[model samples]
Target: MLDWVASLPLWQATIFLFVVVFFRAQLTFWLGKFMRKGLIKSKFGKSGQNAEEKRAGIAALEKYGWPVIPLSFLTVGFQSVVQLGAGFLDWNWLKYTLAALPGYLAWGFIYAFGGLALFRSITNGSIGLLIIALIVAFLVWAVGAVIVKKLRTNG
Candidate 1:
């Protein structure tokens, strides 16, 4: 089933990307809002000046918004957070969309084209490259998860 889907034409892919990006942006926006709420309720944040702190968070989010899109591609939960943060902080949605779209395309091309290139190179050789790829992806996810968990727990 997925193989059939994978063989989709360029138009399908484009539409798919659009839909995915739209929903993802919405999700990110809400995630930021909820995270703000959670932070407010948390012990560390509760004792502080809530309005000032919220404004600071919003400011920090706007300042560092675009980079988060690409960084999220590598990290555990960055994608959603970036979306949410930008949304809650009222960053220009158009700019966020533009920045995130190219980053997403670059990421897809890197992984997809890289995989195909690797396969072509390794066609008559060993499976070491494939194995290494799997291992690296796993390690990336694991490390990202740990970092995200730690940040959430401590922040």
Candidate 2:
């Protein structure tokens, strides 16, 4: 898959990425919608601490609105959660789609360029560089997670 994508023109690869990410996000949103009822009844539903967490999630979404759609892309696992919350909350479809455009574009750029670069580096026998890059990526992710956690706690 990486080879196939890497062979494409940058513009084509970016477009392909945008389409895939956008559709995947939309699919996740619909899945959230479909599971809304079950989610309400399940463990993370309206019972105990889960209820408070749910309320917090809803409040965050409400506080941020459509901007959250795009910002969600920056976080690894949280994007789908936000999309699900958007669907479960019944946010306007047109607004969600429109707001998602820039997010998807950013994702496309990152994946297309970054993936290609990583693929090339690996194929060229640059394992040491790849290891360093992975470590740096992990550190960045860890820092971002900590910052997000602090924000969530303080907000």
Give every collision pair in model 1: 28-83, 28-84, 32-84
Flag regions of model 2 displaced more than 4 Å: 39-60, 115-155
lDDT of each residue in 1-155, candidate 1, tens digit only? 23443466655654554465557666776677677667777887687735664565555555544676666654334456556656655566577777677656654543343334454566445576566567667865774576455444444
The numbered model that scores best in lDDT is 2
TM-score against native, each model: 0.48, 0.61
List model 2 lDDT by residue over 2-78, tens digit each. 67986788889899999999999999888877787676778766565355655675565555567768977765557
How does residue 117 of candidate 1 score in lDDT? Answer: 48
TM-score of 1: 0.48
Backbone clashes, each candidate:
3, 0
